[model samples]
Target chain A: MSDILLEIKNLTVSVRNGKSDIPIVKGVNIEIQRGEIVGLVGESGCGKSMTARSVMGILPGPARKSGEILWHEPDGTVTDLTGLSEKALRDMCGLRIGMVFQEPMTSLNPMMRIGDQVAEVLRIHKLVRNREEAREKVIRLLKEVGIEEPALRYRSYPHELSGGMRQRVMIAMAMIGEPGLLIADEPTTALDVTIEAQILRLIRQMCVSRHMSALVITHNMGVVSALCDRVYVMYMGRIMERASTGQLFANPLHPYTRGLLSSLPRIGKNPEYLTTIPGNIPEAGREPVGCEFCLRCSDDERRCFFERPSEIETDEGHYVSCFMCQRV
Target chain B: MSEEILISARNITKSYSLGRKKRHIAVNDVSLELYKGETLALVGESGCGKSTLARLLMRLIKADSGRICFEGTDISALSGRALKPYRKRMQMIFQDPASSLDPRLRIRDIIAEPLRVWRVCPDKTEMERRILDLLDMVELKESMIDWYPRELSGGQKQRVGIARAIALDPELIICDESVSALDVSVQAQILNLLKRLKKELGLSCLFISHDLSVVNFIADRVCVMRGGVICETADTETLYAHPGHEYTRYLLSSIPAIGDDPVS
Candidate 1:
């Protein structure tokens, strides 16, 4: 029996722009085991968000999705979500798989009281029959997310709370569903470092305590280092490298991954010069020939410009898609 | 190592009235110095008043009680015409270049606006030449001078912001979370550019950021702030290696690093 909680296989997402269907997430593969936190890291235009959205069946209009998104349930039923009806996918989205976005200020309803928002999720899913029961659950959920005054805060509107508080409320809303897999897309990107650390800790604790798996999407390597067990480095919608967090950081194989690592401004002792990637990530659909990273890669070979490299397992579970790595 | 003090803030305190009776203290009795050709970083969490302190130093927002001196000249009381010259000498680069810049204007005009306001350029030709020079200094091609802010990448837009800030030859520049909005690669590019420009122009900088790691890379000295107060101040190396304050330690420990165990 496969222990995978969520598996994405040869997933391709494309958007129609004028005359052509441009692939944003091209032939990507990812797997999240039960109780594991996996990361999808990339710069802007790299389709990290697209991949997450595709999993939730929230792709924008004019976009097309193909391939399988296998979600395994506790009952041992393997559901190929790609072929599921819209109603079934919607049912699976919030109840089974929860999501948190980057901006909590906007993710939450500004008009609604915090209590109603949290309870609304439960009420919609028919998890709670009465208002009083939902209220108790909302306060309980708020307390679980580390809110100081859960009862007092339940009556408060979203605007009355701080950014960190708002994010916690969002987490409460997501967690009220008892989701097996939580997809947090840049959850802490907008938060301060201290608050981000707190949120990351909360997520880690919740994942452990609830036996929940997570697919965290972010560009911050520090976040990946702190939270993720496994990391996939995506470039131009394609995953260039995938390995355990320790292995990926210790010995990054792909040039793009190496560039990202070296480019991070460390906490102490600055390097003489940061090794920045030469160019920005290419726009989706207008990708370069061969490897998407070929244009910006420092060690690009002629073959890199002519042929796409397949994912090669360099070591046990450490995979890379680079012609140079393949050569070695 | 004794060097000339470029700018100094003494006992700066700022507060805002919440509703009718309550006053929320944004910055409380914070004091620091920016030395000639040195980058001083202010590190803190959001709502800790680091940005408010930056604004206070820039006189963008007035402090309740404080004395700010630029090269031994007390600029705390100066206003209007008296503040104009000081304003020219001290510039600021904001966090969001996209919003900081005028959306309707092209890149060249945006850069030249500061020069025009300061009367640094004599004519259109000189201003154009100076704008091209500034673009070159920022490592951007002159051909992009005609492009709008939306057309440029985040790094490029920041470069434009930098060019505008330096157009008047400011001695001191306050960078308020300048590179926080950029991607890592572009952030590195902007940082390198800033480092190079600081050296080349002998510029002193007051760098404010929530990201301690970025502060470590760019700042010579670090001031750790919390709840509107400066908890600790030390040289960057000393501060990072051995932070004295508990909050500083907390902040340091929170920074996620490769191979480091997660802070539980």
Candidate 2:
């Protein structure tokens, strides 16, 4: 039996314009071991969310995707999600894989009761035999996610709960199916700091107790540090760096990754001026022929501006894609 | 830092009617002071009345009770023509740069609107030169002067917003989560720009934010607010090092720093 739960190979997602295609997510590879929490960190439009959407078979309108999304089943069966039909993917989604989005209010139904909305996943998947069974399961899951008084609050509307409580309901909805893989895309971005800590803790707890792997997509490095075991730094549709959390923080090889870490305003350390990446992320399909970060990278050389750098293993289990790293 | 007060709020309170019989207090009996050329941060979670306090200080809404003074003049009660001059002296930068900027207007015209309304530059060439100079001050390119807000990135739009806020050389600027919408790298750039502008122009700022790390970076003083009331107020160093209020301590601890251990 292999430990690999999900493996994405040479994935590419693009959108068509009038006469041309704009590549949002270029060829990229990511692997998640069973029960491992990996982070995909990047700025907006950097294709982190698009990558997640590709795996879930929920790419937005006009976007086209290709390449392999291999899902390793518990019974030694390997299923390629990209080859699955719409109907087949729908069957596999809630039963095999679950996802939580950033905004709970928009993702959840405002008109439906919170309890019914959570139980709908079970009903669709046929996990519960009857309405009574669904209600009991939902109350238990809601309680597990830390909703105080699950039975009383089950009748409440989405608007009746606070932001943190709404997010808890979303988590319960995602967890009810008992999927092997959970994808959380910026689950705490819209939350307050105190509430964000609570949500992150809950996600980590859920992943650990169920022994499920998770792919957390976010731009906040702090969130990555707090939740992810391994981190992948993405920039302009390519993975700039990948390593374990400790190594990535202690020794960031990619200039882009280093720049991001340095730019963050630490809680205790107050520097006179924060280091900044000078240029904005280039428009999709207009990235430089060389390194995608070459325009803003301070360590760029002639080769860095002309040839795209390939991923190189600088140390054990640490990978970086930069001409500078290759030379060192 | 000078001890001279730039703007002061005294016992300010604001409440909204939730329904026919219920009321929600947004801001409650809050008092604050901003010294000359220093940044005072108002830190709190959502629904904590930080935004409402900012609105009260900006005179965007009338307070239920208490007074607000700018340069020793009580402007809370002033209105219409009498309050016109004070309005130019105090400007604001909003959270969402995309919506705060006029989408249809070009960058040049958007910045020039403030100058034209205030008659800062009446001559044609002078106005053009002034607009270009303002763009330069904010480190924006000359070519982007003709671009619309939709064509610009989030950071560039925010730069444009700052240029307009300072077009009249306002003495005070109220930044309502000004850098919250930007990415980390861009947020750093904007913060440095704001710091430089404060030093060069001697502008006092009321920086409101929910992110504590940001507040620690840019603010000289900090005020921790909860449920529409301030729980603690102190210098930034003292506040971060040894929080007096339990709520303040909890907020400082809740921040997820890079070096902190992952929740196991």
Candidate 3:
């Protein structure tokens, strides 16, 4: 029996702008060991969110998707999510795998009470038999996410809460189903620095307590380093590198990964203008024939412009999709 | 230190009544200034009345019990057409670029709105030339003037927003978290532009942001706020080197940096 709770193989995604399928998540593979945190990190339009939504079967449609998203059950049942019916998908969606979206202000219903919004998830997932029991569970969920005066907060609307508090409410709602896997998509990007750190700490601690696996989608290196156990660096919808958190940060091997790490403003080290990846991300249709990151790679060669590098195992559990992995 | 005080606020107090007689004091006993060519950063967490202070300075909202002295006049009491001259000298760049700009307006018209409203140029032809110059100043090309807000990227939209704020070449440009919406790599460009503009134009800026690193880079002096109070104010170097307030210390310690031991 495999301990991997979720496995994604050759997952390719393309946004359907009318009839054209513009690929966002290029051929990718990821495995989330049960109760482990695997971070899919990259900048905007990098397809981190798309991969998470694919696993939850919730990517906004007119999206063309391919490859296997398999969720392993304790009873030896494996469910293939890509071809699941809409009703079946919804039934398994929040209950089996809940997601905390990027912006809580948009994700949360404005008119509903915070408590009722949370209870709606519980009732939808059939976690409680009656409204009273659901209410009790909702309060407990809110309390679990560190909402003080849960009873009072339950009656408050989403707008009444601060960004951090609203995110806490969102997290509570996500956990209503006691999901095996949780996907948090840039949960703190909209918040301030102090609130961001607080929210990250809360999510990390909560995931551990619930014994739930998480795949956090973020662009911020700081957030990922603080919370994630394993890290996957993505570019142009493709996974460029994957390693344990310590290994990835200490010695990043992929050219794209090195550029991103070097670009960041390190603490206590003053530098000139941030060392940026030279060019902007290519338009979806303009994705390169070989390496999507070749245009910006400082060590780019003629071969890199023509031949796509396949993911090679550099070390146990560490993978890089780059010819210069040995040197980078 | 500059010879002239470009702008100053004296004991600015603004309060709003919450339903009954109970009032919410948004800004209380606040006083600050902007010099001829210095960036005064207002650092605070949200709901600490930073936005209120910005609005108060701009006279978007009137201060209930204080004076905003611009140049030499107490313009807090001015309204409608009376305050037009003062409005021309101070421009505000808002928090959200997407919402701050009008969806219906094209890039040219949005930047030109202030010029047209103030009638800065003698004729429409001169206004077009001036608008193009402002676009170049913010690093946007001439062709972008025709594009709508929807056509631009986040960084592009923010540049357009900056162009609009500096449209009239205002003496004081109040940027309220202008780079917060941008990506980290993109943030450097915007910050650099602001710094460059300050030196080139001898512009005074009231740079407001929660990011201490950003403020460290641009601010000549910083006023750290917590819970609607000015916790501490000093020269940027002095404040960072020896932040007296406990909250200020806590804030500095919280900034995440790789490879350095985190402040415990």
Candidate 4:
């Protein structure tokens, strides 16, 4: 039996310029299964964050969003998040679909105590009856995320904690709601490697133990390989490739995916020079008419310059959007 | 690598007074050397004083007690005019390319600023020619010369930063997390550019980064720092294969890689 948690159909996010609307996320379709850790990988400005923000109903002002963000309820009810009002979406955000941002220092309120911030989510949802119950729950959640001396740390301000500790607090805030789906955007990009490992481990443990689905958005291939069950490679606001983690690492079909993988400096492998993708990502509103990556791709062909290639399934679960992947 | 030392630092210490009573030691008594044509990396987490140490070596900040020698000359105490000549020989590429560059200046002027200050070019035509040569060297298009910093992407802005850093043809370049702010593919491109520049110019580089994988790829030697002190120093192969210090081993093991088994 297939258990689908969320389905995004033809999602397009665009921001209005002076006269024309510039699309940031163009026709992205993704499905997350129950308890599956899925990764949305892309560089900056690729609209990965915008997609995640759209799910939480948190797109910035002046950005027009269109598409069906279907959220599957356990009781067989389907909710299209795009149609919901701000009030209704706010009601469902933390309680049903939680999110964790990259910069913990800025995401958290420096003025408030760490304990109160975590407790505020419960208070907003009316999950707890009293202040005492909220405090106890927040402390337990903090301990669960591997924070040492949770009780003592509860009263500390955001500035008192380290980067890793602040991230744990953020995770605690996200998980305290016990949402079915969690969206983490570059959760460990700001931390040290050792601290990053711990945070990744905590996120994985929380998801598995609770049977929760997670949309881990990051540009790091290593993070995708270490934490994701399935991955989507995004480029210029479009999903270029989608496959299982094992399959993606073993056989990447898209030129962009291959370039990303080969460009990374592996720990044990020391090459004289890394293989590089020439040229920079095109400026907004200037993307190529055909393939988004054609300008920087070494394998681009004649068709790649004039006609956009749709997604083609290369394997049972693998899909790639590239001209070379098409079976002649 | 040859034993000819390009720069050396000995017994360098820096501290900050915290609230009049408590003191924060940013860099303890540390000593290191950079060979004439080898890339040496200083790897550590945030607050490990890697940036402070780099600043000290560049003479951007004064060390409380240390001797900084450049080509067998103690240049630590040199100030004002005496430090001017050494400044032309040691340049730095900052981590944030956007803020490090002047937003108001055109790309050509940004690259030509150092050339003008150092008086490398005598006239306007020679300056324009030199700027074009620098743009070519950094793999940036000549069309970018007239555009402002806002028009270029992150990678292109970083290239401009590199062009400015190498305008005066410095012997030693201190890259403080230079590629950390870039995407992986662009980072690889910039790394390749740096490697090519080093080989072509025979430049000595002090690469400071918190990323161990990047260090392993670029550096001939590595120094691992923790809590303002050096914990380990070794050649890249020996450091990665057989880390002498416990902290270095932990850092190596903590790196998330493609082949690593899923934590769950």
RMSD of each: 1.9, 1.5, 3.0, 1.7
Instruction: Candidate 4: count the clashes.
Output: 0
Looking at model 4 chain A, which ten-residue stretch has the lowest summed lDDT?
A262-271
Residue B147 alpha-carbon offset, candidate 2, angstroms: 1.6
Residue B235 of model 3, lDDT score:
88
Clashing pairs in model 3, backbone N/Cα/C closer than 3 A:
none
Pick the DockQ winner. Answer: 2
For A75-194, candidate 4 gives per-residue lDDT tens digits of 889999989998899888998888999999999999999999999999999999999999999999999999889999999999999999999999999999999999999999999999
lDDT of each: 0.90, 0.93, 0.85, 0.93
Sorting all predicted structures by DockQ, with the top scorer first, yields 2, 4, 1, 3
lDDT of 1 by residue, A1-328 (tens): 4588999999999988889889999999999999999999999888899999999999999889998999987788899999999989878888889999999999899899989998988888899889999999989889999998899999999899888888898888889999999999999998887889899999999999999999999999989998999999998889999999989988999999999888888764478667788876666676778999999999988998889999999999999999899878
Residue lDDT tens for model 3, B62-162: 88888899997889998899998888889888777889889999998898888878778869789889989999998888998899998887777888988
Q: Please give each candidate's TM-score.
A: 0.96, 0.98, 0.90, 0.98
Stronger candidate by DockQ (2 vs 3): 2
Q: Pick out the ten consecutive residues of candidate 2 chain A with the lowest summed lDDT.
A: A261-270
Q: Provide the lowest-lDDT 10-residue window in model 4 chain B.
A: B255-264
| Residue ranges of candidate 3 with Cα displaced over 4 Å | A74-77, A110-113, A129-136, A151-160, A253-255, A258-272, A313-316, A326-328, B1-4, B80-82, B102-106, B123-129, B253-264
Off by over 4 Å in 1: B260-264
Winner of 1 and 4 under TM-score: 4
Error of 1 at B135 (Å): 0.9
Off by over 4 Å in 4: B260-264
